[model samples]
Target: MNRDSIFISHATPQDNEFSIWLTSRLEMLGYKVWIDKEGLLGGERFWVTIQQAIQSSAKVLFVYSKNIVTNEGILKQGIENEIEYAKSIALQFHIQDYIIPLHIDDSPYNLAIGLPNINHIPFNNNWAEGLKILKKKLEKDSIPQIFDTSKSVMAEWYENEYISNCSIIPKTELFYTSWWSVSDLPKEFYMYQFSNEVQAKAIRNSNQTIPVSLMSNVLSTFDAKLSFVVNRDDENIELKPVHTYIYSLNDILYGFESDKFPQHRDVENHFKRLLYRVVSNFLIYKGLWRNEMSNKRLAYFLPKYEKIKKIDFTYPYSNRKKSKSILGKFESIGMWHYAVSIQPMLFPFVGFSLKSHILFTSDGFKIIDDDKKQHSYRRKKGKRFFNEEWRDLLLAFLQRLKDDNEEIKIKVSQEGLVMKMKEWPEMFWSEVGYNDPNSKMDLDKIEDYYEEITEESND
Candidate 1:
């Protein structure tokens, strides 16, 4: 049976043209449509083919016209037969909308004869308006399952990979977690807990209802940013953290932990390979899986330059002028800066580097080297630096720095911008160097800058 098909039942010559046109339109929208002239081939029995087509179709479009009501039942017997069969099946299955009544010219008909109480889709001469109504009804009547989209891939991964790995599912309690990101919002939107729909609703909806479609789309966009597949059993959909290793195998660098430090070069490489897989997964999620950026690829783009070339990592530390495990370049471009950093290789803890590039836009930063791009979530229309996104990122940064955690860091240039964000009293004392009441990074300086910018804008 063709579940994605629609069967059209209509009277002769008068309705034939409309049926043909509707069939073409439905076919274009990815629906397999069946009409008498289209479905009936030379040798096939008419009634048998009609019955088969009706049985196969998920919906039936019964076209109504002045001729049907005005004529004696004998003239449109085939269409009447199709409607009777459809009505019987529809009633047996308790389906209310199996047959979609389509009408033109709003001709009055006593629907009590058949298709009683069923709503009609008015497709009167205006095909455009009719198509819109038809398309919406088709979509609403179709499958309830989530479509396979690039945006839903992460959610699917979270459901499959992440959920399958979990041994237990949490219930009846809210727990703070990270790793799963709700997209279309700032990165900080994921940094909270919710035990039920109410909590979820509370977080997003203060007074207005937050559209789940928008939330889902935005969240799917950041699925790669999610380091771990969110455990399905987790009542609150707790996002699991993506972990990396350093001087150890299975040592959780980002979320959870289990350390295994190996001394042998071959064993170390084995662990490094595993860690690279994790990073590669994230890179894929970030949409940056280019051949040039692959771990095995020996060549790397020179940080500030567009030039792609191989660089030697064998030079000894003290003898070389630039002898750091990590190499990076920062170049200013207009109000933004293009920054590229080559992280030191993991295995030998010596020379190999994974080159990554980032673009620091005026409002936020974006990772440009990977297939999955990660960006700072910033509000486009809002107060200069006092929006929720800014506060969330700032607070997350301050919390990390306050705890002396290596998980997060502040860029010097970006921190200067942060200092300027001190117009908000809550944010003022939280500035990096503002721990001391008397400090060089003064609150007054931020106030002065804020006033200057405000004055300039007003002028």
Candidate 2:
């Protein structure tokens, strides 16, 4: 037996030409549209057949016009009887949103008053184009899930090699999440985690939600500046960056430890390969692998090399220059005035250096020199900076989140109607605390917390 077809209920005997044209168009698009003139057969129990057709169809299309709505002859069969019967069948089966109205060259505004949110198609204005819109809306509204956008809404600027690698999802769901982009990166990459529907909508409407990439950049940027602003007194806590070392193999780096497990062996070999062309090294410690331990990290000497770069800057492109290591302060040396352009390569395992181009050696991402005498690392230049469009986009997004949070913290207070956040005893000697009288006692605790935070943040 054939499944029921999509029914087109219209005041059609008077408007027969339109019914033919409309049915023809729908048929071309492969919809088995049931027009009453073609559908009604002089058979046994015509009313039983009509009621069964109404119940089984996935969609009901009501084509409305000027004369048929008020005409008693048309209303008697199509609306007052047939369409009304279809709706009763829909209610019995608990079908929601089954009635879609296709409006014609009449008072379309007045015709659809007080009905449920009827999905209407503009048939009179542009016949083919209107049908296209109707078809898209019909297909989209039919889906069982929300955020089903059959039409293209996301921007194409985010469509390149970079986006494909990073997008956690395909096209963004419209009903699930609204467009809340701080950077021009595609909406497909952003989603608020939610345990339920209520929470999902709540986060979608909030300004506080921050992108993950932007958060990473802000922590990295602030680390450079806080180093200088903080070293005020001998009692004051001095911020020290957690030292990091990247092996040549792993894109991620490992800490200096003497373990000889398989994991450590992999990391050591990864970092060791950078040794060939990058920098000269001195031994920090020697390690023994695997005799007392499982087949873990291999035994090798950890090297102390020159710090080639200091990049303490925020998103929007700003950096700080500072030299830090055990050897430099004892020699009374200040930070080096290194060549500026090569600075970005100094990320990860930055060490102290007098030789120029040390930053490039660390992470210049070298290619063969072509003459084959040497391998030179790669550096971003010219359009490469502009091409960091993803990074820049990530920055702007984080700034919005930061700005919103700041606004939330600053509250208004009273006294002569003069508002101030400085109510914590104007001259009390300063330090970091929630309610403590002085900040002095908490400096060491704060420093330890800062170290832990930076470590976790870097990872």
Q: Could you say which candidate leads in lDDT?
A: 1
Q: Cα lDDT of all candidates, in order?
A: 0.40, 0.34
Residue ranges of candidate 1 with Cα displaced over 4 Å: 38-45, 73-75, 143-459
Top candidate by TM-score: 1
Error of 1 at 203 (Å): 73
- Model 1: lDDT to the true structure: 0.40
lDDT of 2 by residue, 1-459 (tens): 233457677664555445555554455444565555433221233566666777667677777676456643234344546567767766877767677777755444454343436656776544444566666665565522122223211212112312344434434221211112111111111112233444333322231222111111111110111221132254543333233222332222434455542245443333233221111111111110111111232211111244532222242122533222211111121221111111111122322111111111112222122321111111111112221322233222222223223321111111111111111101222233122112111111123433443343256
Window of ten residues with lowest summed lDDT in model 2: 284-293
Q: Give candidates' CA RMSD values in order.
A: 27.6, 29.1
Q: List, residue by residue over 256-325, the lDDT tens digit for candidate 1.
A: 3335422244333443343333333333332232323334552211122233222222212225322121
Per-prediction TM-score: 0.30, 0.28
